[model samples]
Target: MPFFVYGTLRPGEHNHDLFLRARTRSEEPGRMRGLVLYEGPGYPYAVEEPGGAVSGDIVTALPETYRELLAALDELEEYAPGDPRNLYERVARDAVRADGATVVRAWVYVAAPAVAARLRAEGRPIEDGDWRGPGDSRTHRRG
Candidate 1:
């Protein structure tokens, strides 16, 4: 499955270099609906919401790197099956391609229920949904 990454895991971000560089088959602009981006330390968290959307990339990992990448990302996001302290939950969601027509189901790290509640109550959301910002000029290399 592909992954929808909106924050530090997106191309040009620091974590992307450490974890995704040279490990993906493709990385392209995509948008995930029904989620909101919230600030979290130096990264960001995607909290589920009814009328929101988050800008990101739909990343397909190379067959050889898929398993390792999935484990690495789950660790990075602090997601563990049924873990009460988990900050995020890995979920299958639909992500729309840049053209806005094609859609693919991808793994998305959304804020855990507890985290989402807290964020909904008081966290700061990235109003534009793009973690890199509206004037972002970071170029992404497609695999």
Candidate 2:
């Protein structure tokens, strides 16, 4: 499955070059609905919410690197299957291509239920659901 990445994994961000540069088959602009973005330490977290949407990139990994990539990403997100202390939960969701012509099921690491609850009570959301924010120089938009 492709991954819908909205934070450090997006192009030009710190983790992109380190983890995805040569491991992906393709990467393109995409959007996932029903989620909101929250600021994390030097990163961002997507928390599920009604009427919310997030901008990101849909990354398809090369067949040869898929399993390795998945493991690496899980580690990066600090996700472990069925773990109670998880910060993020890897869930599959539908994401639309930038042109809105295609929709694909992709993996999205969203805040765990406990984390989401705490974030709802105290976290700062990126109102527009974009991690890059306006005029931020760290990332560039691409289709």
Candidate 3:
């Protein structure tokens, strides 16, 4: 199965090493639409938006490998699977890479509506280029 990873989970980031440790493959840069990237206190989240987009990477992992990846990511995000307090959920999404090819089957961590609302109420709205991998310092503009 393919998973779409944004934030620190992207390649070359701190969490990327964990994903690599999980033995995932077929990694490639990708973008998902209908989500806005927000910068929280220490990380980023993708809030669902009708016409927004979030850039990330596409990775293919075996179903069994999801267990390890989930554990590592949940730890990093301070979230637990099936926990209501968590702000992200694994969901199927479609993504297109810079090359314009469509990846129709991928799983991505999407921000929960309640979490997004709470963040907005706290005055942290989604910002362009809010999501970045390790060594990615170039400011990304919304397209």
Candidate 4:
């Protein structure tokens, strides 16, 4: 199945290794509309808005590998699949690439409502660029 990954799970960030380890293949850029990207304390989260567009890459994994990828991601996000406090939930959503083509049947990590409320209360505005947090230069060392 195709999964939309933003944040560290994108190509060369920290969590990208995990996805690569799972043998997942990534598509070109795609976006989720109506969600504003907010910087959480440790990572990034998205909040639903009237007109927001969260962009990221779409990755496809084999059905047999989906569970493993999900498990790894859940752990990385400090979230359990069925837990209430979890910030992200797996959902079937459409992703629009830069070319304006939309891909359906993709799973995405959408920010939970509760998490969004907390972020808003903390007065964190949605960042305009890649949400890599403060002190993180965009450079990554190749292994």
Worst 10-residue lDDT window for candidate 4 reads 134-143
Model 2: CA > 4 A from native: 137-143
Worst lDDT 10-window in candidate 1: 134-143
Stronger candidate by TM-score (1 vs 4): 1
Q: Model 1 off-target regions past 4 Å?
A: 138-143
Q: Report RMSD for candidate 4.
A: 4.5
lDDT of 3 by residue, 31-107 (tens): 88888877765667787778888778888766777778666666666566688887787777788876877656777
User: lDDT per residue, candidate 2, 1-143, as tens digits?
Assistant: 99999988999888999899889989999999999998887788899998999999999999999999999999999999999999999999999999997999999999999999999999988888888867874753332
**lDDT scores of the candidates, listed in order:** 0.91, 0.92, 0.70, 0.68
Q: Write candidate 1's Cα lDDT for 50-75 as tens digits.
A: 89999999999999999999999999
lDDT of model 3, residue 77: 66
TM-score of model 3 relative to the true fold? 0.76
Error of 2 at 98 (Å): 0.5
Model 1 vs truth, CA RMSD = 4.2
lDDT, model 1, position 62: 98
For model 4, what is the error of residue 125's alpha carbon versus the real structure, in angstroms, after optimal superposition?
2.3
- Residue 63's lDDT in candidate 4: 70
